[model samples]
Target chain A: MLILIVEDEKELALSIRDYLKGIQDITCDLAPNFSKAVELTELYSYDCLIVDLGLPDGDGLEIIKKVKTEDAQTGIIIISARDTLDDRLKGLNIGADDYLTKPFHLSELQARIASVLRRIRFDGKSILKEGVLEVDTVQRKIKVNGKEPDLTKSEFNILEYLITNKNKVVTKASIAEHILGEYSDMYSSYDFVYTHIKNLRKKLVELGCPDYIKTVYGTGYIFETA
Target chain B: MNLLTKTSLLITTVALTVLMAGGVIFFLSTKEMINKQVDKELISEMHFVMRSFDNLVHGRDTVFYEELTIIPTDEIISPVARFRDTIRLNVFDNKYHTYRALFFGFRKGGNNYKIEIFKSLIDSNTLIERVTLVWIGMSLFLIVAIYFLNKLIFKSTWKDFFEILKLAKSYDLKKPHKKVLLKESEINEFASLNTVITQLLERVERDFNNQKELTANTSHELQTPLSIIRMKAELLLQTPDLTSEQVRLISDILATTDRLSRLNKSLLTISKIENNQFRETEKISLHEKIRSLAGQFKELIDEKGLKISMTLEETTIEIHPLLADLLLVNLLGNAILHNPVENGRILLELKNNILKIANTGDHIELDKENIFHRYFRQSKNPGSTGIGLSIVKKICEYYDIDLDYRYRNNLHTFILDLSSLYTS
Candidate 1:
C-alpha cells in the first residue's frame, strides 16, 4: 500500500516514513510543504494520506479536502501538534478517518494506520492469520488450531495491537493508549497491561500455542513469531 | 441610593426648608407693617375728629359714632393718644373682627372729653392669607419641577456611563475587534472614561492574542522536537544487535521524553483553558461520568489491591465535555497514583453537588496551599508527572468549581464543590 505523509517538520516526517517502511507491503511518499503536498496528491493516487494541519505554505486540511474530494475511497488520518478537541472534531468532521496528536508512539501510529486500512479495505471482515492462530477482526474472535480461547475485550484489543505491529517492540504505554485512549498516559500506570498480557499468554499457551509474545525487559512487549 | 436619587433628595430638602422659613418671616413682617399702617390711620382720624369738633365747639355736643366715639367726663387730663388692639362684634357682618384703636382725653368747652377711633384689620389679614397661600403654591410647584428636572439632567448625563458599562459587560476577547457603539457625552469624566475603557479593552485583547500565539508556537516548536527525539529513541531500540545496557538507556530516553511531552501538554491545556478557548459546554451526567472513569481505571485499581467504594447520585453539570473528562481522569489518577501499593483504599462519593474522593496514602497532610500548584509532587515515584492536580485545578477554575483538599481519618480527600456548575 502506498501512503502519503505531509508534514512541515522534515525530520519528523522522515521518521514516520522510515518507521512505516518497516512493513514489507507499505510504501511512503513525503511532502514537506502544502504546495508540494497538493502537487503530489494531484500527481499520484494513494491508498492513504497522513496529514499535518500546520504547514509552512498553506493549511494541511486543504490537502485532506482535496484528496478526499478526488477519491473518497482513500483513507485519511490527521497527525497534528494540535491536540485540541476542536481541531480533532474538525478533522473528523471533514471526513478524515482518524486523528493523532504529535509526539505519538510510532507503534501506536502504525496500529492506527493498520486499523484504518483494514476498516476501509475489507469493511471490517478481515482475518489475520499467523500459522495456527487466526483473528477475525469483524467478529472480534480468536481461534487457534480450530479451537477458541476466551479473551476479554481489553485482551483482545491488546492482542490485535500486538499482532498488527508484529515483530516490533510495542511499549506498554502504546498498548494502553491503543486499548484505552490518548489521555490514559496521564494515569501513569501500566500494571493493567501486564495483567492482561499475562492472562492472554496463559490462555494461548494452555491452548497448545507457542509463546509468541516476548517481553523486552523494561521497554515493552514484542510479538515474535518463529 | 444612586447618584441621581441622592442629588434630587438633597436639593428638595434644602429648598423646602428655605421656602418654609422665608414664607413664615415674610408673613410676620407683612402683618406687623400692616398693623403699623392701621395705627397711623387711626391716629390721623382721631386728629381730624378733634379738629372738626374744635371748629364747631359752640354748635355741637359730643358726637357718638361706631368708628369714632367722644364722651364727656368731669376730670380734666392732658390730651395724649394711645393705641390698643381690640376684638369687637361687627354689626354688618355679625362676626368678631380685630381692630386697632386710638384713645385720647381732651378739654373742650371747659369740659373733659375722651375720643376713641378704631380701624378694622380684616383686609390686612385677608391680604396676608392670600400672600401666604400663593407662596405655598409656588414653593410646591418649584419643588416638584426641580425634582423632575434634576432627574432628567442626571439621566442624560449618565447615559454615556451606562453605555460604557454595557460595552464592558459584553466584551469578549475572542472577538476583540467587535464594533463599540459608544454614545459620546459632554461630561469630561464620562468622555475620558470611554477613552480609558477602550484603551483597556484594546490592551487586554492584544495581550490575549499574544498569549494565544505563544501557546500555539510553543506547542509546535516544543512538541515537534520532542516527537523527533522520541521517534529517534524508538528507532534506536530497533537496532539489529543492541546490548541490554543500550536497551536500558534507550528505554530511559523514551520514558523521559514521554514525561516531557505530558508536561508540555499539561501546560498547553492550562493556557488554553485560561484563554477561554474551550467555550463549548453541555450538560454531563456526573454520576455516569464517574462510573465510566471508574471502569476505565479498574485495572489500575485492582492491581494495587485498592478498595474503591462509590456512592453516586444522579447529578449533572454544564461544562466542556473534554474538560469534564480531564477533570475526572486527573482526580482519579491522583487517587490511584498516590495510594499505597497494597491493600490501599479509595472512596468516591458524589452527593448534593459535591464530589469527594478519599484515598489511603501519605500519613501526613499535603500542603493545602501548594497542592494544586504545578509540579507539586508528594511522592518520589518517577512515573508521577506532578501536573495532574494542576490540570484538575485549571479545569475547575475554568468552570468555576471549588476544589479543596484535606487529610483526615488517615486518608487524603479531594473535595470538589460543583454547585456553581450544577445544572441539576
Candidate 2:
C-alpha cells in the first residue's frame, strides 16, 4: 500500500517512515510542507495519507478535504499536536479516518493505521491467519487449528494489537492503553498485563499451539510468527 | 453605611449643628437689640415727661402723661435721671405689664420734686419673641431643606460610581461576557476611576492570554521532540544485535520520555480547563461512573490482592462529562495506586452527596495544604507522575466540589463534597 506522510518536523517524519518501512506492504512518501503534500496528492493517488494539522505553509485539513473531494475511498489519518475535542471532532467530520495526538507510540500508530486500512479496504470483514492461528477481525474471535479459545474482551483487544504489530516489540504501556483506554495510566502496576498474557499463552498452549508470544525482557512482549 | 447614606447623614448633622447655633445667636442678638430699643425709648420718654412737666409748669406744651408719673420727695435727689425695668398693673388692660421707667429729681416751684416716667415694654417683648419664633422656624426649614437637597444631589452625582461598581461586580474572568464599557462621567474622579479600571482589566486579560499562549506553545513544541525521542528509543530497541543492557537503557529512555509527555499533557489539560474550554455540561450518574471505573481497574485491583467495597447511592451531578470521568478516574486511580500491595482495603462510599474514598496506605498524613498543588508527590514510586491529584483538584474546583483529605486509622481518606453539584 502506498501512503503519504505530511509533517513539518523532519526527524519525526523520518522516524515514522523508518518505522512503517518494516511493514511488508506499506510504502511511505514523505512531504515536509503543505504545498509538497498537495503536489504529491495531485500527482499520484495514495492508499492513505498521514496529515499533520499544523504545517508550515497551510493547513493539513485542506489536503484532507482535497483528497476527500477527489476520491472518498482514500483513507486519511490526522496526527496533530492539538488534543482538543473540537479538533478531533472537526478532523473526523472532515472525512479523516482516524485521529492520533502527538507523542503517540509508533506501534500504536501502526496498529491504528492497520485498523483504518482494514476498515476502508475490506468494508468490515477481515481475517488473519498465521501458522496454526486465525483471527476473525469482525467477529473478534481467535481460533487455533480451527478451534476457538475463550478470551476476555481485554485479552482479545491485546491479542489483536499484538497480532497487528506482529514480529515487533509492543510495550506493556501500549497494551495497557489498548485494554483500558485513556485511563490506563491510572494503573500503578502492569502486573495485570503479565497475568493476561500468561493466561493467553496458557490457553493457546493448551490448544496445541506453539509459544508464538516472546517476552523482550525490560521492554515488552512481541508476537512472532517468523 | 453606603456612600450616599453616609454623606447624607454627615450633611444633615452639619446643617443641624450650624442652624441650631445660628438660631440661638439670632434669638440672642434680636433680644439685645429690642432691649436696647426699649432702653432708648425709656430714656426718650423720661425726657419727654420732664419736658411736659416743665411745659405744664411753664404753660408751653401738652403731651400725653398716661405712661408718666410724678412723685414728691422731701429731700432733693441728684438731677441725674435713673432708668430701670419694672412690672406694674395697668388699668387699661387689667394685666400686669412690664415697663421701662425713669426717675429724676428736679426743682419745680422752689420745692424738690421727683418725676417718675415709665413705658410699657409689652410690645417690644412680644416683637422680640415673635422674631425669635420666626428665626427658629426658618432655621429648621433651612436645615431640612439642605439635608434633602444634599441627598438628592448626592444620589444623582454618584450614579456613575454605582454603575462602575456594578460593572466590576459583574465582570468574571473565566466566563466570556459582553464588553464592559464605562459610561462617560461629568465627574473627574469617576472618569479617572473608570480609566484605571479599564486599564487594569486589559492588563489582566493580556496576562491571561499570554499565559494561555505560552502553555499552548510549550505543549505543542514539547510533543514533537518527545515523540522523536520515543520513536528513536523504540527503534533502537528493535536492533537485532543489541545486548540486554542496551535494550534496558533504551527502555529506560522510552519510559522517561513517556513520563515527560504525560506531564506535559497534564499541564496542558490544566491550562485548558482554566481557560474554560469545557463549558458544556450534562447529567452524569456517579454510581454508574464509579462502577465502570472499578470494572476497568478490576484486574489491577485483583492482582494487588486489594478489596474494594463500594456503597454508592443513586447520586447524579451536572458537569462536563469529560471532567466527570477524569475526576473519578484520578480519584480512583490515586486510591488504587497508593493502597498497600497485599490485603489492602479500599472503601468507596457515596452518601449524602459526598464521596469518600479511604484506602489503607502509608501510616503518615500527607500535606493537606500543598497536596493539591501540581507535582506534589507523596511517594517515591517511579510510576507516580505526581500530577493526578492536581488534576482531580482542578476538576473539583471547576465544579465547585469541596475536597478534603484526612488520615485516620491507617486509611488515607479523600472526601469529596459533591453536594455543590446538585445546588447549582
Among these predictions, the greatest TM-score belongs to: 2
Expressed as tens digits, the lDDT of each residue in B1-424 for candidate 1 is 8888889999999999999999999899998899888988887887787888766344556666657767777776558988888988787898999888888897765788877787888899899989999999999999999999988987887887887889888876644435566667688999898888888877887788788779766865788899999998888887756787888899889888988988888888877776667888899999999999999887778778889999999998999998998898888888888888877999999999999999999898898888788898778867677888988988887666889998899999999999999885
Residues B72-145, candidate 2: write the lDDT tens digits.
Answer: 66887887978777988887988999988778887766767777777788887888788878877887888779
Query: Can you give the lDDT of residue A72 in candidate 1?
Result: 90
Kindly report the docking quality category of candidate 1.
medium
Evaluate model 1: give its lDDT. 0.85
Q: Please list the Cα RMSD from the true structure of every candidate, rounded to 1 decimal place.
A: 7.1, 4.7
| Backbone clash count, each prediction separately | 0, 0
Model 2 chain A poorest ten-residue lDDT run: A123-132
Badly placed stretches (over 4 Å) of model 1 are A123-125, B1-212
DockQ measured for candidate 2: 0.63
